[model samples]
Target: MDFDPRLTPARSDLAARRLQARVTAERFVDGTPARVVVGLAPLRRGPRGDARLDTEALAGESLTVYDEDEEGWGWVQLDRDGYVGYLPTHAYMKGDVARPTHRVTALRTFVYPALSIKEPPLDWLTLGARIAGIAERVVDGRAYVITASGGVVVADHLAPLDRVEADPVVVAERFLGTPYLWGGRSSLGIDCSGLVQTALEACGVAAPRDTDLQEAALGTPVDLDPAQWRRGDLLFWPGHVGLVRDATTFLHANAHVMAVSIEPIAAGLARIAAAGAPLRSVRRVERPQ
Candidate 1:
């Protein structure tokens, strides 16, 4: 079988560079698809009696772009989490447009301009709102974000973007007290790697999803003691990740705490070291200014 596009050389240095350039803050409007097509309403199918999109496309596919009529009604291909199918253009909006843009956290903010104020994922906040104040990796890809106001939103969810170097520990600290959520990747609720990824993104750095993907993306491992570590240094063990806040402390989201929190890095390492887990690996990702 072919390699996963995310795993292959599809995202080259040139592409990575371009991603760094074009990623702006934005949202997705019309081009969305059901995570699964449960069933179809008549309007979802073409009026001229075209085949239903759900009947044709499989899960995790992409759709084509279509033209809209003067009345603002048209057929467009809908891509949902990689699944592409046909849907009405009217269902989307420029105000709701979702494309990839590289930007930092604007505020300790919330998603706005939404259908509802409560826990909505498609809601968005003002662009360029706050200074995320962290360092991210230097690579490129679209990011789905959550606003502090408990709203979900995807900014430039499809475009690629790159981040330059910044400190991971400083980045992690910004999200301190952020609640933990499974499969979450934003300031609202985040996982360990999600915490890492978002922290890096805020600092204009890039990292992969999950601990394993992130570990591989770091290129190679480095061995060093706490005294030798710096702000952006990353710490990892089996099934967990933490960012060095300094020589003594680090930040992470843990099920144990069930939210983003800070702790003594040396103490954590001491626990692990005493348990004889041994250090799986360590790496320092720094972006050149």
Candidate 2:
């Protein structure tokens, strides 16, 4: 049977011939678990810097290293989303994976060596990056969350591990004006499905990374009429998806505007129709009653 490389793990039978054969021959089964060390490690389609960027692994995210090529690229599967791709082997460090105690809620935050904001940041963390808090410190009346890795992050930028945002739309709207990047999953640059996935994940809702998988798995189908749509509804088109801002408006990260923007549902529909990618489906994620 045919398999989509994007959705299938490298250990599966449908993976590439070399990977399948390697797994079948018992050369490797479960790969080594590692943590991303850089700000944003590019996951590429091939074991080269010039290869197509499929996705990204944020700092502190867990991944399983399957194999490494001579070029120093490691084939891995992202633990959070199960996305398989190649990233430089040097970008990962195998060690005790700290249990995350909080998640970054800001578009981006800095990790400082001290509690003072004036101290130069040691690293930058994008939204959704998980952090393990080893201790809390107050320096000169400023509070900071100290991570197990000896990095300090602002307390206000992180939320407790169990805290889930009340509304996905509210979470999505915070990224308004973020620039569009085809495979980006951060507020610095994001795409249609990335925006949706980021928003839903903040609300403690799991989501797939790609539009087609999201369309197939997220939420349940609802009426296609814009009039029937409510806030937090998802509208899908070929290769795209958007969050319903309200009864008549939808928000999306679009290449047309090159940024996240809100547009009337009717106008968006007309524009997409003009491009021959008409509205395909409407899905509503049922909320707690």
Give per-candidate clash totals. Answer: 40, 0
In lDDT terms, how accurate is model 1?
0.48
Candidate 2 residue lDDT tens string, 1-289: 4556785655433233445543343344557789887777889998889898888888778988878778899888888788998989988887677878888898899999887898899889888888889999887777799998889999999999789888988888888999999888887888999899989988888888999999999888999877788899999999999999987789999998999999988899999989999999989887542
- Can you write out model 1's per-residue Cα lDDT over 1-289, one digit (the tens) per residue? 3334332211222122223444322322323222211111112344244543222221112343433455534444334222122344433333322333334334233332342334443323322222111222222352344333223334432112344334556656767787886655555566787677666655555566567677777735667577777766778887677777776777788776799888887777787668666557777776646
lDDT scores in order: 0.48, 0.85
Query: What are the models' TM-scores?
Result: 0.51, 0.92
Name the lDDT value of residue 275 in candidate 2. Answer: 96
The prediction achieving the highest TM-score against the true structure is 2
Clashing pairs in 2: none
**Shift in Å, residue 50, candidate 2:** 1.7
